[model samples]
Target: MAVLGAVGGLLAALGLLAFGLYCCYVRYIHAKYDHIPGAPRESFIFGHLPILWRMLRKQEFMHDLFLQWAEKYGPVVRLNAFHRVSLMIVSPEGVKEFLMSPQYSKDPLVYGRVFSIFGERFVGNGLVTVCNHEHWHRQRKIMDPAFNRNYLIGLMETFNEKAEELMTKLEEKADGKTEFSMLTMMSRVTMDIIAKVAFGLELNALSDDQMPLPRAVTVALEGVTKTRIPFIRYMPWKQKLIKEVKESVRLLRRVGKECLDQRREDIRNGKEVTLDILTQILKGDALEETRDDENILDNFVTFFVAGHETTANQLSFTVMALGQHPEILERLQAEVDDVLGAKRDIDYEDLGKLTYLSQVLKESLRLYPPVLGTVRWLEKEHVINGVRIPGNTMLVLSTYIMGRMERYFKAPLTFNPDRFSKDAPKPYYCYFPFSLGPRSCIGQVFAQMEAKVVMAKLLQRFEFQLVPGQSFKLVDAGTIRPLDGVMCKLKPRSCAGSCQA
Candidate 1:
């Protein structure tokens, strides 16, 4: 009996030893083959979750650390987060390759649920979320006309009108203040611009009273950003929050559908379709044959979400950067003064002449790009910078870190508009504010024009200076925003003379 008991114990011990050996072989031997260079790894169970959390908490200069990692490791590094392995690619060449590759697709698991709120008929398989190659091609062909240069030029009046209203609103708010949160103000302006341009609905978010549509959209986005945390996904409260978000989405869709239905009715009654994006999208001949209402709604939601948030954040960052650098602001103001003069209205043609303003906007985008990182999943195995990446790997390209890498630019940390001047030597893949290749942002020109008009108009009436004792730190949420909000004293500038206030 004693001998039999000893044998059973010996067998259990052997089983344990074999399992440990298997684990070591998988972790040390196999991992070396699959891993990218320079990326730190976590233990087999938890992976890099703790490291990622620490980096995320630091907030300030986190991008700098990412750049350092890129420099230490090769351009491509493999990081494990909560058992999920991710590839971080920092080189401009690598970024260009991944962004341009047809094999790479946006990870729907990361973006799908929030997008599903747009309803199955309108969003279930829309252009932004659809993966089928033929569908993408067809949708792109139909959507291209809406953002064409001629179409954008036609929208300039809408842009100008919104800008004028925004200036008046700012003047009222800044009557006695020297500093205000430009982030909040710019959010309002961009929301109003998008609402008017996209839906032919005038939503004056710049006013003190919150507009219902913008408020609902803001609530929905806030909820979406919160759900991104892994811990948040497990809580019961998360389910409740998601339910609330769906309700908000329903409200937003109801509003959108009402507007769309009204327009469609008008078209049927022989009224000519307006030049708004919604009009073009809903009534365009390109999509006339497609019976997918879900796809149409998806596109609408994509435009609504993508259209305002990043642009608004970019504008706010531009203002903060301008406030910090008085010389650049003064130069921009001079250009605005020279171009627009005392005229209250600036035409679309006049926007082209604001060369210095364009440069300033370009520089701001470089320093604090709206999107810090973009992720694409490989449909097939691929080699990036001589490193073999397996299929289904998430490739994360950090624009935020790349813009600050010394290898990419001279004095990359410094905000200098001169870098974009005609004499500046620029490499092809180094600077990609709007991304590159076939999948590049189709609305780049429109976004640039809108930013220029809004910034030009604001600079004409106000001189912004950073407020004292305010903690204006980057809050890297959905887009990089100021954690405490940007507090700046705005002194109204005379349109006719120097901005002495």
Candidate 2:
């Protein structure tokens, strides 16, 4: 009994020692080296997790929290979460350095899993996810032709057609109704645009039954966003989620293959192939020649997934914003009416004349960029803003926060389209709706053209007003969307004459 008691005593002593050592280790990590600036450290074990969680749940605006941190801790702030050290850079100068610097690369851990689920070959080091210097350069060179001015001009008819269909559908839905979810209508329209542009197929998803292809693709995308959470991919629930994602990916792959096969058949038969993005990609001998069938399919999937979701969110928000501010909407209506002026279709040439419409879209993007933030990992140890950051540190730049900074804009919170006017003062790095630099969004032009086309047609045909007492709160899902839905009343605007709300 005495021996056992002594052993227990020794074990207790050892436990106490270990506990003391752990506390010391934590203190060491939490201890601010003069080299590291700005971020307040919490208890070593929890680090910044609690602060982040609280801010995430309670703060309606996350950008505000980051901005506050920047104000308190300087432009660069250090945070530790999930045993990973992170640096948040708020200054435009810092952002420019990182985005432009070749040293910074897409964090593989974050994007690798995304690529894995989407299938490795289809993404084939595509522009959105790839990091390798040589690979990205090659991919960018090959993909550049698809976004040329001539091709975009060619796509104008399709954009107008889709927009007309959208307007007509909304008008029909608002026949007796005071308000409907214009947000949903816009989502469906953008999805249809992406389908037609990328695949040479007009899904017409706005009016049609939910197609299996888009539905599966959306599900897979949702899975990827959730799986990005640390260790969530390993959980049983997440494993099942991943399983569903894999199944959805397989379905999408099959659909993509079918589409490609059809295109190939048309090519072989000497039928005039559509001048859509997919056709252009297939015809381009540079990348497609070296890429396999699966790689090509991955690229298509990537394009569809990235292209649709971001634009859909932007379009939805733009409509919601215009609806909330009737004056802006009224002005937009007048502009569209004057520009199109009873034209059955808005041709490519007319787009240049619709400068006001472009300004509204630009302002909306500035207010709420489709991508709130992007993460990039440091490939080498680097100093940012006089702080030493070790290699592999996760660096985050919140475009949402950056867009709202007073340093970047005057009256940052207000929704003013005039800021982007021809005579208005421009600030460097102030607007990055599609991001800036070589790694910027490849489909930006396509997205803008589609939004303008849709918005113009809707303004020409219908007038929208925000529903009273309806909260249009921004919910951060894959993209920012209304927490409930964007419930708005629509009254058709007759082109023959102006009508009051």
Candidate 3:
């Protein structure tokens, strides 16, 4: 009996020793990014996980932390979340290799997290979140005609009407002493515009603050961003957030089903089809290559969220930037006055002519892009900046960090619209607010058009002032929006109704 017990003890000791050796190999030897320089992890097990959680919870500014790491460790820095190792690749060559090819697909496991938030299919299999290259290609092709110039040109009528409604709403608020959230106003208008232009649904977000669709979108996106945290779904305290998000998802999907069904019924009734995104969605369904009801619903939520959210944030940031720099604001307003001249109906031709307005928009996107970065799943090894990167690793490309780097832009922190002027050389890979290459945002044209019309009309009507004590800090809740909602007061510009400024 004593000899048998001794033998069992010896075997247990050997097993623990083997497990220890394996952990050492994974952490110190076999780890893919072990060679790269990075800030030391806060915990061997947690690996900066707690730091990220604290920062996110506190609503602290964290983008600059990544930039700081980049400055210290160079562009291709390593970061860890628990045992998982990911590379933050800011090198232009790295971006070109990873993002330019269909070979490196979107990190499925990473984007897949967005598919179902709190047990609800939020984005589902939409164009932005889908990882399958072939599927995304087919979907992109089918949706391309919807954003064509002619189709978008017709959208100007809707844009003009919705933007005019926003202006009227703001005119009442521009008392020069009453402070209000510019972002909220922008959200309402863009939400209304996207609903009208995309699905012919009247969200009525502009006039009604308590609208069900807008609130649902807000809650649904909250679900998306919150569920991203590690082990968040398991926490007892997160039940409220999870339940709210799931309900929001249900609301959005339910609304989508009704809208799609109505559109199909209209088509069956031999009704004249309108030149809107709903028509394009039906066209895609007609194609033999792609016809899935859930996929169509995925796009409905995608268009609603992606269509309105980013543009609203961009306009809000632009307003904040203009408010801070009166000279820049004056110059932009002057240019708007020169081109638009109080024209309520901003045409597609006029959009191109508002060159300075375009510059300001570009500059705003550079400083505060709606999307900070994207992740790519690499299946093969590649070298970036003379460093060998291992295969089967997650690669993070951050425009937020790159845009702020001095190596890419001179006075990277300054708000300079001239940097985007026609004569100035365009930023190659370093500037990708709308992203670049084949997987770039399909709604780029539509978004920019919507931004221009709203911005042009706003500048044409009112001169805005920033309210005191408002933080210019940014917050990342799925998409980046101003932390303070861009608190502002406004007074009418000289050209309120006429062509003179």
- Index of the highest-lDDT prediction: 3
Provide TM-scores for the models.
0.87, 0.86, 0.94
lDDT of each: 0.73, 0.73, 0.86
lDDT of 1 by residue, 219-315 (tens): 6766655655566646886777666666777777677677777888888899977677687667543446655555566677767767887888888
How far in Å is the alpha carbon of 114 misplaced in model 3?
A: 0.7
Clashing pairs in 3: none
The ten-residue window of minimal lDDT in model 3 covers 492-501
Largest TM-score belongs to which candidate? 3
Candidate 2 matches the true fold with a TM-score of: 0.86
Better of 2 and 3 by TM-score: 3
Number of backbone-clashing residue pairs for each candidate, in the order shown: 13, 5, 0
* lDDT of candidate 2 at residue 43, scale 0 to 100: 47
**Superposition error at 294 for model 3 (Å):** 1.5
lDDT of 3 by residue, 303-361 (tens): 98999999999999999999999999888877888887757788889998989999999
Ranked by lDDT, the better of candidates 2 and 3 is 3
